[model samples]
Target: MRWSLTVLAVMVTTGCTGLELLVYPSDVLRIPEDTLHNLTLSLTFNTTQAFDAALNRSGSVLVVRVVPDEEWKLKIVNTPVQFTAQEVTEAACKTVMVSGYYWGHTRLSFYLTVNHVDDQFLPGVLLRDDVVVVVDRSAKLLDSFFIMGVTLFLICNTVNMGCQLDLKLIWQVLRKPVGPVCGFLSQFAFMPGVGEAPVTGCLHTTSLTISMFQFSYLIGWLIFEDPLQRLGLFTLGCCPGGILSNFITLLFSGDLNLSVTMTFISTLSAMGMMPLWMYTLGTSLTSENNYMKVPFANLAISLVSLTVPTGIGMFIKYKRPRWAEISNRLIKPITVLILVLFGAIGAYSSYKAFLMMNGAMLLAGLIITVAGYAFGAIMSKLCCLKRDKIIAISIETAFQNAGVCFIVLKLSLPTPERYPIMGSKDGHQASSVKFMKNVTFGPIGLRTSLWG
Candidate 1:
């Protein structure tokens, strides 16, 4: 029995390795023993056409398509590559490679055209860009394992706490008219600001900024802007407070019981609110044929993932307070270790995206963090809450469930066919990491607000 228990513990700790191997098979790196020489293709495009109105009479955008021989199994190398008119103009031509799996002679074809903003095609524009690529099937299985393991460990740590849900205390707080009112305003009304606003009906500067950001994204989509990117930003704004709110509350020596209770309330409330917010704000963003598919299963899973561990923690607190205290003490160091590991893995894997990330991304992260903290404080102050409760509310309002938002992005946004076209997967992953890093700024803001 002892041996079995030990085995279970080890399996639980190392499950991510198994998951990685299953998801990213070694066959990705293995070439068939009987394979012949590798295959490559070269292609060209002309960028000078962008300057010629007579040639580009149809559109400003360039489209390139490659057609390989039906007998050959071909794959594009370094897919989702970005190219600009300036790069093409400077180089005069661009080349891409395609790798063939089978040992046989194959033929290749190219179709190039220019597209206008209205999706009209322009003919007679020759782009002088040619490239061929050989596909490298080498997969980064270790990186995958590391990222998944770190995420699991972080979630486990966040949930592995004693739930001190004081029913009587929660009831007393809610029974007061101010408590319910404050909770409603914090979740629904208080938000970050872009600029100034009249302080009336919860529409302060911070809240106005947040609202404008969300609304502008929706409006942008309506006006045929980058719809997928705008959808991602809108979803981030819609997420409710995260489980990390409880940890921040504890860190600031605020009311642990109240924090836990509010987290529970908000999470349960999100089940309804999330879908409602998405539907209300995103109706114009989707077509009737391609309506946004909400990941109800993932939402349910997130709720279960949070509640089950919290219930266990509550049991520990009630039955084993000393053990709970020890577990809590251990979490701090473990969290730091996990963060360091995450940073290394993220930096290594996403170095290119990090370089490509612009000032707009940093500004977005900063605004999300600052606005959450500032508006939350304003709301709490308006409610006339005491210092401790005010601190709890502020933290709760500022820290959103970025994990849940990421999941939604992964599951819902950008269909499989459009993944490569939009580079949605990589874009979201980078943005999610940036958003999480920026979220750390909230606790600092909270601490500063408390001191002030």
Candidate 2:
């Protein structure tokens, strides 16, 4: 009878020793996903006496941790919270902070325990909250700056590129159709094949380029285990040459006329090619392809952006030859300044995204750019094109219109799949830019240019 009575007394004492903490207001918290700074939660004991009991039996410190935690998600800012028995008695409530990293919903549990080694008291996790982290629709400072800078740069640089074009050379090159044909093959055929992206139309003739494309497609099919990786790579390869290519071409003293011409052709063709590839190949990547639109408005804007500035420059060249010459001299320096300015800003703004990228994705981006240059150079040489033409074709082939990819991914994929691909594409865009010193090409000498 004495043993039973003692056992019952111990059991009652053990049950009463567990400390429980309660949250005030509610057990659920709704906060913005962008809350990386801190969020204060009001913590209180389950009963008024619980705090005093904890201090006497457990200790003065309470350790807290988040369950199912990630660095990109909810995390405790500091370690175990410290307190004194007198402080607990005097304070109204205790507060703790948790950081919200990304957009997602999770049931985060705050486990609390005493920081004592005496084993006199046991701690219980009584704080379980349903955290709903919604997306922050607020406009960031860097985003606005990036947009404004890019827009201003594009308008100025495109006009500058147009001033470099020699209409007679463009006409002559078009008439012969050699360099344009090579560029066409490099962009549409060879690149897509290299990326294992499906082409919109079938080629009628058999040639080495065709064989290379098929071979590359075969390689990509066999090698890439993840379909999403193929989709991202293929998307990058399938895009037309961006305006940045023409800027790059001018800096390198490549055939500006050829580069401009090829850029126009590929971009115009992209209206049809982009949709076709997305519809067919996109289905293979994910079923969400059905909901994807062609973004025709963006394509039209691109075309207009390319042509309007160039048209103005061409008029300037025709009517005021002196102004054109002066402008050409000034344009290269301005281009270099713009590149340097944006490169620094971009690096600063995108450091977090870069941190999220894996090493394999970064290495793959480099390989894709290098392979594009190789294909363009080899194909141009095989076609017996001039050095300037070779350089132009290579620049055009290697640089994809990342803006187009951004729109495509944004509109096409769901949020879960979209962000990762977008990040990978951003990494690719950063890697693909091959900055070079201004050099000599044909009659133009850029030895005195800023980069030189």
Candidate 3:
């Protein structure tokens, strides 16, 4: 019981350690007058602009009035209306127009100056140039509800789910999975929208991502009695299918060692292969693919991100089995919790973004995205590999590198917050972004299902 308690505490603290909300000043007001200055004015707007400032409107004043969370008005001039604040925030920003105009200073510019609302010197902790404050009363409240509700749901689900996944039993049953699942969602939750999510945006994503990705498949060999530890070509290609595809092959005539070996190879092959695969895939997709530069540097970063730490983890797990057990019991679940939180937050943000965009278009996009997976699956099977090989290759083919795509989007839409955002279905549009979670792709081996 005490060990469980310790594990639980570690999970909560570690999972949330990286979360924060950034507030900033508008472009007009963002320029800090002096390093010693404290008061800063920020702007948030929600209307279309006749002319564009993002293009280069030299003489523009962005005006924002400071009111209590529920009562505030911010005016941005010359930017697209998309709740694009001039400030930077990983979390969502919330804004509403108490009153404004289609033309004039309110529409032409956003201007703000700092003043103490409460006599006391405004604490720097609350204000930073690096991060921007996306304060909206409506967004705050609604987001509060969103956050509180999801958090409670997650907590309940995690506990209940954890209880069912008998660690010992699963460890015994799982034949040393090469890693975790990788598919469109498994592979491309953060990947570009060439395909659709396996599930809807409204999902307990982490729960699904973890269970489905990690242990859904297994790989065993005729040559080796054990279902894992193969350093071969098949494993190179298939280990990514995780346990799901791995075991699915056992039903058919499958070579477990090849898949395992292939997995080891595939995971490492990112050095040369990821670039080659992505480039070839992108070029085939469309002219836009050619236009889109694959950030090989970032891809390299991601490969290192997963490989190094996990290798260390495995080493420790092997060298000190007890410590490995302790760490796995703690780190793996915590990692899952963090990922679940990431998925839920991303889902909420995506949902909020969906609400803001044309509903029909986004839905169409979703359908097309999901359909991409089906297309990939069909293409994989048609290639004429064995059934087991099909599973490995299918996973390899279906999984898109989402983390890379999102990074590209962020790079492209660096200052998108400057646009005027439409009113959102969830009261505060920006609030949904508060937990703009990071996408960590690659294989993640975490426990799922308590003891049903």
Best by TM-score: 2
For all candidates, the clash counts are 25, 0, 66
Weakest ten-residue segment in model 2 by summed lDDT: 1-10
Q: Under the 3 Å rule for N, CA and C atoms, how many clashes does model 1 have?
A: 25
What are the TM-scores, per candidate, against the unseen true structure? 0.56, 0.67, 0.33
What local distance difference test score does each model get?
Answer: 0.46, 0.57, 0.30
Ranking by TM-score: 2, 1, 3
lDDT per residue as tens, model 1, 278-307: 565444334333345556665566567667
Candidate 3: worst 10 consecutive residues by lDDT?
1-10
Rank all candidate structures by their lDDT, best first, as comma-separated numbers: 2, 1, 3
Candidate 3 lDDT, 1-452, residue by residue in tens: 00000000000111111112212323223211111212222222221331232124323322233322222222332222122223311123534322221100111122132212212323222211221223211233445565565445444433322322333433432354322223333232222222212333433243234323221111112121211111011112221222223222333334433333333344444445434433432222222311324455765554454334444545554566666556434533553564466456645543433223333323323332344345445544555444554454444433333444444433322121443222233222232222111111112111110100
96-141 per-residue lDDT for model 2 (tens digits): 5555443232234555555342245457543443332222223467
Question: What does candidate 1 score on TM?
Answer: 0.56
Q: What local lDDT does model 3 show for residue 392?
A: 47
Model 1 error, position 170 (Å): 4.2
